[model samples]
Target: MKRQQPAQIKGLKKWLDPVYSAWTSIATHKLRSSLTILGIVIGIAAVIALMSIGRGAQAQILSRIQGLGADLLGIRPGMTMAGGIRGGFGSASTLTLEDAEAIKEQVPYIAALAPTFSSYQQLVAGNQNMNAQVIGTAPEYMFLYNLEIADGDFFTDYDYQRGSRVAVLGANVKQTLFGDEPPVGQQMRIGGNIVRVVGVLKAKGAVWASPDDAVIIPLTAMQQMVTQPRTSRGERVVTSIALKVTDQNQIEFVTQQITDLLRSRHRLAPGADNDFNITSVQSTVEALKEATGTMTLFLSAVAAISLLVGGIGVMNIMLVSVLERTREIGILKALGARERDIWGQFLTESAFLTLTGGIIGVVVGCGVSVLLSRFKVMTTLLSADIIVLAVVVSLGVGLFFGFYPAWNASRLDPIEALRYE
Candidate 1:
């Protein structure tokens, strides 16, 4: 007669018997199991929380930059470099209002462009006096920057043509000068020149550039009343030109055209570099992505170290478990349990421990993320992919660390294991 098979077990219920037994064994030593799982829980939670914070920072930065305008380009003065290093600051007179007018006349893709001139001046309102940066720009500045009026209206073409002493109050400037009182129609002294506040801009919130910190006035008024007297060279000048492109896709083309035109006008040779720097949304986005990528990598590495420690803890605990269960292992072996069955039982126990910790970790990480979002600190976008990945990694840690102990237990001789004290 053939040797009787060990009771012909079948179906999922039969396969789960060993798993159930392993779980019971772990439950008997509740404190030890909970402590072992706590390490994994903390580690996985750290990984998820840190990664979410990094991603949130990236999103916030990108949103702020894009909020300025996707189709805008900024031109500032810079040196022409011959070799690897920069020579020095380029000519101060490189960019001019004439160039801005030429671009408005020549480039069809250019929707609007404004020449900006600025200075820090003491602004006086009744008995209130505060020093703030004053920006000089044409009426078109409002449209180019998407600045909206909270009260009254922006200065018009007639104001620019007449060179009127009209000003627009930035959000913070209004608060400083008038508090809760309406600033529209109020006359304020800027550099001893009285200018009427025709418009008060709505609060734009604090942005990276902080536009709310400056006071805006007609370009002509600023050039004549504020800037010309201070210029030793006696040249009425503007600092930089901000341009709004008709289409985002045409930014590169328009930027190149503007560069070539400005270079030619500035008497730069074909081989010589231009005297102005052009900043576009695309360039800003690329730089931000690179910086954020570096930060993510660094944070991930730090979190990975925690995960490694958790893995080691699991391995150590599993080894101790094997030694503690030596008699139990021998009893099963003596009852004719196969080596594979012993391995399966231990592996299941280890996986269940880690899986439990991982589930709890995901919940805690997401809870923290939600709290952060509520406080307007950052966003935590916990997608299905990340959740699945966390689970897989947790299970992988259990399997990887549990293998050695499981194998060692499985290889024990039945007679020796039976005699183990």
Candidate 2:
């Protein structure tokens, strides 16, 4: 037991000796050590801050997409080609109210469906007038679009069935038309018809075709105002159809089933191109996530360039340190210090410098992120993994850059070092 105790004590001393020597050397040249640490600090801080911004942007995109309802699927009429000039999606009136009804009856796993017609129209409330996207849809549209009433009640099925001229206002539209005052019970004019405001929707943030800049009315009422397109069988034409799935897991399956059913209903020949376009909110979210993830990785890589610069500074300083301590290394060797001891000490000094800087940089970076979010400049998301990455990266840079200097110091000749001035 006594023999083993001596060996353990020696091992402990060997490990701690290098750390103590490194600290002493750093303290002796505080200014130089600080300058070396400052480079690492800036590098690590830049990495953390830029990564935080990238992550925040990714989160914002995800939030906005999820806000659109994960189980939602949007179907729009496909393009029309005339004289070889192809029009954009929704230009052709290939879909009808009967198609929507057929899907509601045939397709399984459907929670709710909304067939809609939309057009740009001038809305006038008192003397306030502005051009806004006007949507004509049923009450089910509220569920499919994930809309919430901020002020008043949405129109009911009774209002829809009777084609009552009731309207719902989006947050931006309400703000522009009525400001802070309640807009419910107010009357607005659309085209030549007068409509009563029934509700106001909450702000959903800006996205492609933002609902915040739209006004909603019953589908039947919209047909009366606009020049309604009709099928050969006299079925009313619709611009788009939005449906929600009962189970989020069944979204892909339901989407395929909808495609097949729509193709069959439209009587398109086999292998022919579809006259409709379908978009899955879940799939869209995944695509956006992939794009954002790539962007975040790119931003992180750009920020890491500073870390390379810092590492070069560390290598420069370490080489200078080795040159200045050549005589000291020789004296230690003459006093019976081993080569490994010198190597360990210099490497420990380099690692300690970077590790300290890494910690300080983390604190500074977190402070910057908080300030950005608080001031509404940008949103930031910091995770435990990021801090761990910073520590590991900083330590890695030190070890890699400090190697040559540590080796050079360790290889000095004891006789030559002892004779140095």
Best-matching candidate per lDDT: 2
For each candidate, the alpha-carbon lDDT, in order, equals: 0.82, 0.89
Model 2 scores a C-alpha lDDT of 0.89
Q: What TM-score, to 2 decimals, does candidate 1 have?
A: 0.85
In the range 1-421, model 1's lDDT, one tens digit per residue, is 8764455544665877867887898899899899888888887887777778777788878888877788989887776455666555533556777777887887769888898888899999988889998988888888887888899999998988888999998899889889989888889999889999999888888456666878988888887776442223343446788999988889989998998788876777888766788898678888998899688678867977888888888889999999988888999999988999899888888888888888888888778877888898777555666667777888898898888889988988888888989
* TM-score for each predicted model, relative to the true structure: 0.85, 0.89
The runs of at least 3 residues in candidate 2 whose Cα sits more than 4 Å from the true structure, single-residue gaps closed, are: 1-11, 82-86, 179-183, 206-209, 231-235, 332-341, 411-419
Per-residue lDDT of 1-421 in model 2, one digit per residue for the tens? Answer: 4555588789998888878888899888899989999999988988898889899999998887787778889999999989999999989889999999999999999999999999999989988999999999989999888788998898999989999999999999999999888899999899778999999999888585578999999998898888878977788889999999999999888888989998998899999999999988877888988999998899889879988898889989999888888899998998888999889889998998888888888888778877898899998888889889998999998899988999989999988877777
**TM-score attained by model 2:** 0.89
lDDT of 1: 0.82
Clashing pairs in 1: none
